[model samples]
Target: MEKEFNQFIEKITLTTKQKDEAKTKYTGVCKKVHDYYYDCNYDGSTKFLFGSYKLKTNIRPITKDQDVDVLIKLPQETFEKFNNYQSNGQSALLEEVKSILKEKYTTTDKIKSWGKVILLQFEDSTHNIELLPAFEQDDNSFKIPNTENGGSWEVFNPRAQIDAFNESNKNSDGLTRKICKMVKKWRNFTTSVSIKSCSIQDWAIDFLASNKVDQLEIEEILQKYFEFIRSKCSSDNKSYVETVLKRIEKAINYIDDGEENEASQEFRKIFGNEFPLVEDSSKTNSFDNNIFSTPRPWLEN
Candidate 1:
């Protein structure tokens, strides 16, 4: 079980070389944006890395949805100017950013515009970058443009979210971040859990901060996670939570029966192919029966 869990972590984590390459690519993209804004006389605007990349909870995307989220912080005066010039200034700001990048990358690749962000696709890579144009408010919060719903602005503070994740991870001995990555991998591969990535991080942070569980072992942490899901599903029988609860219960049953191979397979069904497969030949009955038995903590009540 320990070996299988280790393998799962290995598969979910980005390799050192991959991280290095990603840093280089991200830096190049940021530099291009900086150059465009500089030439346009937008001196007070700055760029920030946010979302899963900044939080370090990103997993390998199963589809072509791999991307990094960046925010362009426009100064208060510039924001006011844009707003006063156009009734739908929020969307106008987005267009301004898009046009700047389009000029920079038009010869190389086409930049796709979505409702809230502009996607810059790389020709030879699966990863893309999403640039969000936002206005810096007086309180250091951000009002990002939302092109949907007839165009408007949405408030957000990525710095607060980042700080919450970092502090929670510190309290949990970095298990909060690890669990976030695991949940991302699970969500990427599972069809039942249709929750948003941001919501998933919120749920994981809440669980890590509130739950009192043994943090030394992954198995204990996973058991507590299953328990958390069970609690969330107890009130809704027809929800996706219930669907996932069934799978978690089955995995726990396999563990109780000393069927390591079956248990590993069950976990793979829940977490995806990144989970390691345990062979029948490698099964061992020498594990502490008290640690994994019937009436498991996750299965009780």
Candidate 2:
């Protein structure tokens, strides 16, 4: 089971080629943003990769909708200019960034302002970059635009969050990131599970921090994580949580019965095709016939 878990991790991680492509594209976009704002006190050092990409917990995209988040620190002057606006300065800031990207990606129809970030989608349908233009604060936090409501500036401290995850991951001997990636796979596989990726990572970090996880195998750790997350699930997602708990119980029963192949099939139901079945094992049950067959109400559109 440990060997199978290792294989599953390798299978779900981004390929070297995919990582290279993402770096090339995001760096190019960062360069464009930097060069355009160079005269306005924006330098090459102001841009950075954040989110799952920076944390190294990102999973291989099951769909083309996967994205890379890039933050570009705007000059203080730019912030002051926008902050002085009496109306929706957040919306204005997004539009301005969209126009700047449009200058470089003139032919791509997918470039547009999306809420707080400027989304520059590529033709390959993978690694689309979500560019965030932010103002660096004295305390190293960021003030990013939020176009929703009457428009506002939101304080973001991803660097601190990343540091915390790094500390927890090191202390756990890498179980923090492994469990995060596993949960993300579960999220991608289950259509009705709409939990945010960051929320999943936070849960893993918190769960591992409170428990003695050093002696637990990957399967045992995963079972504990599922149990821990159930309490965190809200009324909105309780049904999905119940389904996951039931399936996890079945998998554990199979493992206890010494039916490793059957256990693998049960796990596959939770984690999707990225999880490997034992050699010569029968095909697993289809998700279409399970409780996940029904789409969440909001996803119907």
Candidate 3:
């Protein structure tokens, strides 16, 4: 069982590395666009890479193929055309870049096909890229104002959140206490738990930055989550246990949504006969059992 868990941890960790590499590829692309935008316009500028990669490595290892995010201010837009909450200038700009690169870029023998992606090589050697354009805010962050559908690219810098995540990781000597906080942050980054494809740092940032999980709650959740992480480490069930913990997190959420029986059912799936209960348990030892084994009465009851 220990061996299996260890394998799980290793496997998940590997998945994170792969995802990180993909995001890095895109980061490279963003760097090129930022430079190209400036060189063509003869204006000085910088495009910021904002995503999981900015956080501490251990805090947000990539789990899937989520794109690396980039934010910047376009140089040519008129004041009437762009502001913090609005901008449609980028799509036209992207096409111009594509055309210019296609005409001027020289492809090497290894290159079967090439375009603007070639220019992005300036950012990183490994190439995974996604293009998002935004206007700058007074806060040194970019804003993508929302449309009626709430699908606006609108976002703010995760700098403060990243600081919080770094502090937690540093204080704990590399352990992270922002489990829920991390998940909350990632969700804002257009990631979902079912995908497990985002950098952990992104999630931690969202958690730290959003009002969803405050500091005290973050600490409290981590205290329990740590036990789960350690229990997996001790039992040698690291990966599957991690999976199970994820299930437990979801189950608790179900309970929060008024789905108590559904939550218990979810917990039972992971725990089998060792399933625990809180209805008749001692108060002093409330946090002791495996989170999955027992119905967290504070929640379930």
Candidate 4:
């Protein structure tokens, strides 16, 4: 079971080819943005990679909306120019950035200004990039535009968030990232669970930090995770949480009963196709009274 779970993690991770392609594409986009602002005395060196890609928690078998996030720090003069606007300065800033990108991606019709970022969607969904134009503050935090709700500038500290996650993951011996990636797989597999990716990471980090579980005990960690997150689910999503808990319980029971293949199948149902299926070595169905006898005291009624 441990070996299968480890293989599943490897399967879901982005391949070397995928990483190289994504880096090449986003780097080109970054260069274009830098060139556009270079004549204005902009240093062209403030771009940064953030989100799941930077955190090394991104998954493979990419979906259309799966994208890399890039922060491009605009010149301070540009910030002053937009800040001086009487109203909707954030919207104006977004529009300006979108127009700049449009010049380079002339044929790509999906290049548009989203709520807080300019979404540069490519024909190959795996190569899509979310470009965040930001103004550097005195304290090193970034001020990004939010065009929604009459437009406003929001302080974003991706650096701090990334650092915290790295620290937690290190302390947990990489269990934090493993659990986060697994939860993301669950989110992708089911439509009923509508939790955000960031929220999933937060939950995993919090769970691992508060509990002391053996790093090698992946199954036990997952069992505890599902039990822990049930109460954290909102009223609207409680039923979905119950569904996951039941499936995990059944899988654990199968493992306890020495039904490795059956256990793998049950886990596949939760995490989707990336989870490898175990080979059925024995067809004998031996009825045992001790099946499902293992106590799961954490499961609530």
The lDDT leader among the candidates is 2
- Relative to the true structure, candidate 2 reaches a TM of 0.87
Tens-place lDDT per residue, model 1, 68-186, is 77887655666676667546766777777778777667657658777888888877555578887777777878888777766777898988999898898888887887787776777
List, residue by residue over 1-301, the lDDT tens digit for candidate 2. Answer: 8899999999999899988988888888888888777765434588877888889888886367678988998888988898899988899988987888888876754898867898888877788898999999999999999999878999999889999999999999888999999888888888778888889889988998888878877787887888888889777777777787788778778878878888888889988877898853333445445657776898776
Instruction: Pick the TM-score winner.
Output: 4
On TM-score, the stronger of 3 and 4 is: 4
Candidate 1: segments with Cα more than 4 A from true spot:
39-45, 148-151, 215-217, 226-240, 282-301
- Residue 245 displacement in candidate 2 (angstroms): 2.4
In what order do the candidates fall by lDDT, top score first?
2, 4, 1, 3
- Give candidate 4's TM-score: 0.88
TM-score of 1: 0.79
Candidate 4 structure quality by residue, lDDT tens digits, 1-301: 8899999999999999999998887887787887777665434377789888888888877887678989998888888898889898989988888888888787744788869988888876676899999988888799988888888889999888888899999998888899988888888888677887787888888887789897536888887887788888788777877888888889888888988899899998999878989876474333233455656788958
lDDT, model 4: 0.83
* Candidate 4 residue pairs in backbone clash: none
Model 2 lDDT, residue 174, Cα: 88
